[model samples]
Target: MGDPAAQALCAALRDRDWRAARDVLVTVTDPDDQAFCMYAAGRVPDVQEWIGEWADAEPRSTLPLLVRGTHAVHWAWQARGSASASRTREEQFREFHRRLTFAENLLDEVAGRDADDTTARAFLVTAARGRQVGRDEAHRRFAEVVARHPWHRLAHAQMLQYRCAKWFGSDEEMFDFARTAAAKAPAASGLAHLVASAHLEIWLRLRSGEDNRYLQQAEVRAEVRAAADHSVRHPQHGRYAGWPTPHNMFAMAFAVGGDHAAAAEQFRTIGDQVTELPWAYAGNPVRVFRKWRGKVTDSVA
Candidate 1:
């Protein structure tokens, strides 16, 4: 959610001003922010009831259903069982499927009412992927969303996850999508981070220290550099709704590729901000970040 929107929504909710909150929500133009607000609002029963009442008042509005679906899928993904209980995993998967089914149905309803609802289409991609829907169905839903909003960061990221080998997609397929998506995105749009995301996925799949060798490959090095220059070094580069993570991904890639100077620049840009992703794959995110940040910072010193 946009910081301003989040703040306004929080204040309205605190003041029990449902009408004001609804007004604030209806004006949110960013699909990702809209979905996030719905997810956050879904946490409160009273807020949900207010949302349901709003939906009743405006049956044609897809916002309520879209929020509900996004919230359900977000909740379902967190249903992972405890590590010690094997049966719990099975139970969790069953419950996950049930919740996903409900979410998918809600999204489908929204689609039926408004085929052009980009947010709904994006959630459909997520819902289908989570339900283990076939690659073809997953791709179809993703295509529907990206076809309408080519620069959608969240949609692209979700599709990247869908195409990951761990999710029944091969590395070749994942890289193909990542490259194509990156190429289609404008340089300043920061969508080129899709390639960094793909590289991270490929690295995580390798055993032990092999990822270092993989990152050193000629082709990988070339692609990573091109993406970095376009999205991270471009004069037009600026902050987006999703910033720092992309810069952090590039920083990790450059560090692994042994370009300490380039890596150091990225770290300087990132400053104290850090994301668990890509780094988390290595170990404790904070420790991993410190290791790389130290590696480059020390070189300059």
Candidate 2:
């Protein structure tokens, strides 16, 4: 979503040019953009090798710590892989916990020094999930972020993941949270994507035909249309670095739900900018994207 700034930062981090990365990161002023940027950059490989230099270089600044801590969360998950707990090995789980703990410490340091560090606070919500820190702890970390920046798209997204049935909450809990948050966010804010995300999450959990059936339900499809109007489809929707993600999510939601007309509209808006999520939950991201897109377009044609 916030891939542009993250790509620049990733390039700098890859080159081990902390100064260049810092220069690029400082240009982004919005706290949620800052959080989104760091979260995306966290996927860069071997950042742990040289990020400490940035930390040492700017002992007082939380940016380095933010980068390092966010990277650790990604690093932790990489160690764990995307498999279910039963599919994951004991060693992988151990390393996942260790890296998550390391990330938590660094994030905690940032939160300590900068109470307003939403980037740090947001990642802690992620860390809570990795560590399986239970609902209360996850909520506390989420509370920390919204208390500072209410309707923070980044924080809300992470918190929504934490509350998902796959994590700690039930399907009911997840839907309630998504509906409430989407309603609470400004009409133009990308936060309404949470509804799409929740729908996509439930779809992922259901098996095969059941998944498609759930999405195609009249009430479910209706809810998504309302959310789309409230956010991405809204005339006032602000196109930002993360704009494509919601479009992609809704596109998949519609195509799978048999609303080819709606799906075709979103695909036109999306073009080639496919996100890894909702699609990845199905099959090869690009393949899945094109498959559904072709089907929807043909149906509409």
Candidate 3:
């Protein structure tokens, strides 16, 4: 079955056995299996042959191409050496936007027949964009989707992450929602880590001033550090690996903690990495630095 083959490929990827996974994926005729295979190929180094083969064979399919597009974005983001890294960053951004738009359109096509899946996938596509623009809009859409399908863990997790960063409501409300979402997510997949990291970012911001009450919450600080450490130890644990959020969050934390130099260094490490496919930079280094610089200046002034 496609699920088993997909699982096997995921396992192979986890074990770093690209060759075997590629071979295993080659025999799968199912669309989902093929998509997962393409996803795996995109992760491996020097697999142009595999990527080309899959891309050429399934250029129109949203799932496989989405995987390829994300990988391409990762490559582009990583290749960006500096802020003035020329037109490539812009090009990659356009490409990711195109893919995300295509995925959104595809969701419409399947909506009538499989509304739940359509909503779930659409949530993923839009949540990726939540990092760029439309934070509030994305949150609204994700909330609607999750309301319709409460079991969609990814969408719920993403909604929580977006809210944490956007600070949708009071600190108490955001903290409560974030803690609940982290508790609900499966531990192995690292959704918990993702949500917790977002919480940590907010916590760091709230604690920027000595008078902040949440600064004394040892549990929050401990959770944030733990999430960051977990993410660092397993970068590829989630759907979108090499995304700049974790790195940017780490930098933001350091910046807020009065370590401007450390924050700058963290941002610099991600300066070269291309933005993730879907081009979610709602929390990218450029934006993060812009915000951090403002905060620093405000603190000094």
Q: Write the per-residue lDDT of candidate 3 for residues 102-131, one digit (tens) a residue.
A: 444444444433444423243443335423
Query: At residue 81, what lDDT does model 3 achieve?
Result: 31
**Superposed model 1: Cα runs more than 4 Å off:** 1-3, 6-21, 32-60, 81-88
Candidate 2 per-residue lDDT over residues 95-173, each given as its tens digit = 9999999999999999999866788898898888888897888899999999998988878888888888888888898
lDDT of 1 at 145: 80
Model 1 steric clash pairs = none
**Which structure among the candidates has the greatest TM-score?**
2
lDDT against the true structure, each candidate: 0.75, 0.88, 0.47
Model 2 Cα displacement at 92 (Å)?
0.8
Could you tell me every candidate's TM-score relative to the true structure? 0.85, 0.97, 0.42
Q: Candidate 1 on 1-301: residue-level lDDT in tens?
A: 2356756765675565656776887888776566445545544434433446656766777766766666667666666433334555687888878878877888888888886677778877777666788878888888888777777767788888888887768888888988887787788777788898898787877887898888878888788989988888888888754467789889998888777788899999988878777788888998999999998889877
Which window of ten consecutive residues has the lowest lDDT sum in model 3? 273-282
Provide C-alpha RMSD values for all models, in order: 3.3, 1.2, 11.0
TM-score, structure 1 vs. true: 0.85
Off by over 4 Å in 3: 1-96, 106-137, 143-151, 166-176, 180-195, 203-301
